[model samples]
Target: MTLPTLTIGNKNYSSWSMRPWLALRWADIRFEEQIIPLGPRGLGPNPDILAVSPTGTVPVLELASGERIWDSVSICEWAHEQAPEAKLWPEVSIARALARSAVAEMHSGFSALRKALPMNIKRVKRDHSISAETQVQIDRFDALLQSLITRFGGGQASWIFGHPTIVDAFFAPIATRVRTYNVKVSAPVEAWCQTVFSDSAFRAWEAAARKETWIITETDEA
Candidate 1:
């Protein structure tokens, strides 16, 4: 029998793709990946992505049953349902609510930061400057992350809520963005970012990202 397949774009630049990809891996769900390189500057009218994705975007999860999940968060939710024992969300009630909230915030917010500091795992720009708008979002991000760590981090695991969850998976790309752009964060937040970097699954993804020759010039120059 065929396994489920995840259709994604360039690993180096596709933050949306990274979310569900990491979630699936962390949940120990076995699936294949299909890479459809984005068009120049990562703005695609690409026929390949359009064929599999209703929204013509990357990170579409095609189940073995042939049903497709198109949104990143939806795909993560699906993975959680498939593997509830994986504890993708926090087990505690309030903590789980907060984790869901955090994921939702990431899903709809942070436009400035997302645009100004695109994820480029293969590159580092320590001298990159943050604009006022981006700085506002960054500050918000840092505060939210620090609060979560302080409240739910349990003083043991570096992950929020004491373990890797869908929250961490959703923010993993932002952690890479912080590292790639040298964005200064609080010590706890920094530690969480480091944990994201050190995860074996994330490392494997990073290794592949570094090997990809595809470059979106807009993000490359960012």
Candidate 2:
């Protein structure tokens, strides 16, 4: 059988691509990957990407049946659908609702933090300064993480909702950003970041990212 294809950009710089990629990997779904190099500084309008992606972006999932799904979160949702047994979201109704909320917030909000600290998995900038708006978002994220951990963490599980889920996959990229920029975070948040870093799937992706020679100069400067 032909496997589904995930079209992605540079692993070193594409956080959006990383999200659904992690979801699929962690869910143990098999898929092929096609990498289309992004334009300089990661600016796009690339005909190659545009040909396959409706949004002219990376991280599009093309199924064997010829269905195409775009956007990181959308692709993640598709992964969940493909493997419901993976339990990508929390099984508990309330917990699942909260998990979806967290993923959606990460999807739509956090613009300031994203703008200030773009993900560059191969690079680390210790003691990097962030803008006031970025700090506000970081503080908000910290509070959200703390709240989730306290309510659902059950002491032993490091991931939000007490186990790895779509929530973990969605936030994996942000965790990389925190480490990349050496952003100060609370102990619980830091522990969660460690969990993300230590994940085998994430490690595989990071290893590939480090090996990639493509450089988006704009994110490299960040």
What is model 1's C-alpha RMSD?
1.5
How high is each candidate's TM-score?
0.96, 0.95
lDDT of 2: 0.88
- Compute the lDDT of residue 95 as modeled in candidate 1: 91
Model 2 misplaced stretches (Cα beyond 4 Å): 41-44
Question: What is the C-alpha lDDT profile of model 1 across 178-202, one tens digit per residue?
Answer: 9999998888888999899999999
Looking at model 2, residue 94 earns an lDDT score of 97
Residue-level lDDT of model 2, residues 1-222, one tens digit each, is 999999999888888899999999878899999999875634557889989998898889999999999889888888889888888888889988999999999999999899889989999899798899999999999898888888888644388777678888878888999989989888888889988888899999999999999888877887
lDDT over C-alpha atoms for residue 141 of model 1: 92
Clashing pairs in 1: none
Scored by lDDT, the top model is 1
Instruction: Assess the local accuracy of residue 14 in candidate 2 as a C-alpha lDDT between 0 and 100.
Output: 88
